[model samples]
Target: MNDIVDLFVIGGGVNGTGIARDAAGRGLGVTLAELGDLAQATSSASSKLIHGGLRYLEFYEFRLVRESLQEREKLLAAMPHIAWPMRFVLPHHSGLRPDWMLRSGLFLYDRLGGRGLPGTKRINLRSHPAGALLKPSFRTGFEYSDAWVDDARLVVLNARDAEMRGATILTRAKVVSTTRHAAHWDVEVERDGRIHTHRARKLVNAAGPWAGKLSETTGDPHRLRLVRGSHIVLPRLPGHDQPYILQGGDGRIVFVIPYEDDFTLVGTTEAEHHGSASEAVCSPEEKAYLVDFVNDYFAHPISTDDIVWTYSGVRPLIESEGSARSASRDYQLAYDDDGAPLLTVLGGKLTTFRKLAESALERLGYGGQWTARAPLPGGTFDRRQGVAMIGRWMEAHPFLTEAWARRLLRSYGTEAETILGNAATAEDLGQDFGATLSEAEVRFLMRHEYARTAEDVVWRRTKLGLRLDAGQVAALDAFMAEARGEAAAAE
Candidate 1:
């Protein structure tokens, strides 16, 4: 009776952490348990855009697109370091949708979000800088605005903010089972090979692709259409900062986004995933599909050999009768209060996570909406100050390379000072695990960001995996293992 939490959230993806942060900020006692590291699942595996799903306009999902557009702007203003605007170039394809239809869609997209972002405009691809990489066949294209985000970092920042607001965030923890009592629910969590029980006034299941399986514990027929979306990272395409929205002839759209400064991210194929969501991966066919799709638009064709890294994530869309490509990206909140309140999030997009959280809390009867204006951790600075902040950091730490300083600032924002601490030189930052990744940053992640393993650091917390060799990865793994051992011995 004494150890009761007001809200217990399962899953550490954007939705779960977003809900926990919102609830905790509103003075509700919250506990969030993640089966693995934060964002280790579908959250980090996203295409890394805080976009409005412009293509959804074709599917007549006006509400979803409009809300996502609004959320995109809100997130950019709140966390400029991790989320910023990027223009998408949609080349004209005479064989597919007509140019007029494309223009009409862009027009609706521009007007739908209340004109906060740059309006969509036609571009002469033959003359623009973006044209240089594209084929001559793309004589004309339209450019529209959308925001890009560090998806994994978004999850971590939300979880961190929630903790600061007094929510207990447990990584490497799983809710083994739940039992509804008369007025509350008993949640059994397995952490570090030990089981602990806690009571909660309400329980939230934001388990992404695993929502269906987790809902089985409640004896509900929670069906989800598991769709696998995969991405491939390649060496930077020689061109502008703008990304591309490639329309495949097969009625699917693919995105070629600029990623991590030196890479271009190309992705997202829609295929029904049948097995465990955890086992989802970019199949060879998916890779070929993406490569072929992108090759259609770019003058320089990309093959599977050009791919630097590939990742796949399962999307748990609400089950409906349609092809995977036509499935709705809109989210659904199912509430059951026959006993204690139980909220299960069915499907959602990364861009509208905050909105989704607000809805979830409202459904749970938590009072007031408080997250709309609040900035995420280290995100209190004005959006215009992102570049200035980096410059200031570089000026203060003259020992850091411009590239290194920028990377740190972009990743940690104002908190970069905390990570850099009093280090006077690169050597003071501790062992270099290659690609500018040092023990200092690794320790910062481990201590503050719930990074527990080398893969967590390289793959999720940072994209240094794209640059580090296998030997360097092994070195990092050994270093982290030793560091954990030392921490354990000290304890």
Candidate 2:
């Protein structure tokens, strides 16, 4: 901890981890410290789309949209397991923007970034399968290609890849203080009731919502506007697999997408958040807003009673002269080299994390942008081989149900084989905590993925929390606790 490293990153969200991975791959000695678990905040609370920010076109953020669209293709190719192409159906509403406007936007979107996926096309609501559950007034819709991602897992995988390339990832570690020296930084980190000081040539303040507060310690005079975005999950709407992009009357848009296998994920509302970012939650008002937003289009209206789960995250946007909904989604990297170098990341979305990382390093006087081609851990195979990989898993282990096999392939990719090992039967994989969550898989996550608690395993590492009942979750908690105790005793 006393040795000076090349970089010290203060955050474990998408941007922080992406920077660590990219820097480590370029032969920089990097260390990343997270106040809590990885993706414990805004990074995990995204709408889970890797699109080019189609709505931003109206805001005239062409540069951000173009970079994001380009990054979307690279990210999907890099992590085929956790990210994939998803088509979004935007229903035409006569009361809102005109059809020609929508067409023009989609046309620009299709050509803005390099074409890795299918382009936009018009569809008849009465004939398209995605429109079956919609209200009768919608006669036309536009379908465009974007990508879906396991947001939380994406953060964890970046941390994993960073560690694989020689970056030190510290979780449950909080930076209590930082002192700038002539040539290096002295960062005091508190973990496990002990304080450790690490010296680094440069520091990166990538803390999402907390970045503004952290910047105050260094006298960085940048202000951030905290915007809270919330989402709600419900039982899957019984019709199609494609997601919907609903245009709200407030000039904002919401997404209702298929989540996990049995639920629908609808989001999100932009409200000015006051107070602590960690305290942000899906308020009753926000929940009502979302339920009403979707009810406007769905033929079978849904009430708040249908909601199964809710989550919210606070976004730290650079102070702008507009409403929260109109604030920019693009990022700004401010590098201050007064004493020791400090790069503060402000206002970024999930789709552009990789690009943000490359830019961050270049600002720090480092080069070699190699993350675009490097695959994340277990994502070494081509994206087209995903189905073949699943088939191989099922063929190798007949005990695995088709659903279970597909889940494993999607979650871990090539690493799924390592978890299976030589187990010929489901019983060999150890205790089944229901919903196909096996003890072997749980241990693998704890051993390799830095999973410390059942919440980390179920909620962040995987969305199996939606399937596991309270009792099953309790059992998982007890098991993980006992396992940790045994590990400590062994040490």
Candidate 3:
């Protein structure tokens, strides 16, 4: 925190980390400060889809869709472990738009990225295996492509890659204030009750929902619209593998995607978020609404008791007059001049952070002057490389359980082995913190993933929160308390 950095970034969500990664890859001396654990805010609470916001097609966001579509494949190729493909099946309903209209949209979805993925196909719901979980009334459906992303890990990976490129990342360090001088910006960050100041030639506010608030810290009163989206995790349906997209009686579309190895994720009510982002949570009414919607169409019924977990996020949409669902997910970036420059990002989705970062940098005057083949840490594996690496690693470590190995592969790609490093046996994994969590893995996350607390591990670094027991959760918190103290002691 001594040397003046070329770029100082606020927020550790996907946007800030992504911009840091890109800037560092371009050889910029960058430093990023996160007030809380990385992605603990809105980033980790997302529905975790890296799609082109298929429903946005209704609002004629073709340009945004096209860019997101292009990013889908690029992201999948970059981090197959954390970002991969999933197909969403939309069942045709009598009241909704016709099949022909859906088909046309699917066709566009196919071509949006110039064939980054296969085109959509019509599904004979009754005949296809995917339809077995649906009610008898549903006979036809449309299947389209999209990628599922590990939102929090995506942010961590970007931060990791940035660190590898010499960007200093400080987690649990909140930016208390930003003051602009004639030539540079002075940032004061508070960590463990201690205040530390850093100087940067340029500052970027990539604070996700808090972007506007951070702008105020720099004395720029930018406006932002906060739209809340909530998702519920329920017991998985029997034989549910592929994801399903259901149209509500209302115009909104809901996703019932296969989640962790044991559960299913259904959700998302988009409401105008009119209050603090810190208080965002799935409301009682939204829970009932989602359950009712799912039971209406699915063969299996779900009740509130079946919901194991729930999360909500405030999407910082560019304010518009229409309903929250109709609001644009497209991002807005602005910078001020007067010698010291500050860049701000308004709205962004999990899928489009990379593209968003590129655009923000361009506006910050890095356009055309630089280019990068930058990949997130552990993302050196292209799709083909990832599989080969996973197979080879598993083969060499035959003692490792297939389930454990597979989970690690999907979570960390080739870097999974790096996390498992020299462990010779399952017992070497240390105390079983429940689920597949081991003391080794927990320590690895603390060392590599920028995790500061149990929430950082269970909620963000891993989705084990959905599986850990109450006692296990307590134990993890105990360990986290010690690790956090250790982290502070180091400084």
The lowest-lDDT stretch of 10 consecutive residues in candidate 2 is 215-224
Residue 333 C-alpha lDDT in model 2 = 99
Query: Runs in model 2 with CA error above 4 Å?
Result: none
Give the Cα lDDT of each candidate. Answer: 0.90, 0.93, 0.84
Q: Provide backbone clash counts, one per model.
A: 0, 0, 0
Candidate 3 C-alpha lDDT tens digits along 1-491: 56798899999998999999888877889999988888888898888888888778889999999988888777877787887788788999978888888888888778786777767888898999988999999999988888898898988989998898899999989888888987898999998799999999889998888888777878777888998888899887898999998998789989999997789999799888888898899999989989998998889788999888999988888877978888888988887877688888888788888888888778887854332334566767667676567577677766666677778877887788776777777677788898779888898898888776788888888888888888899999899789878877998
Residues 321-377, candidate 2, lDDT per residue (tens digit)? 988888999999999999899999999999999999999999999988899957888
Ranked candidates (TM-score, high to low): 2, 1, 3
Give candidate 1's TM-score: 0.98
Best by TM-score: 2
lDDT of the structure predicted as candidate 2? 0.93
Sorting all predicted structures by lDDT, with the top scorer first, yields 2, 1, 3
Steric clash pairs (candidate 2): none
Give lDDT for model 1.
0.90
Please provide TM-scores, in order, for all candidate models, with all chains considered together. 0.98, 0.99, 0.96
What residue runs in model 1 are displaced by over 4 Å at the alpha carbon? Answer: none
lDDT of 3 at 225: 92
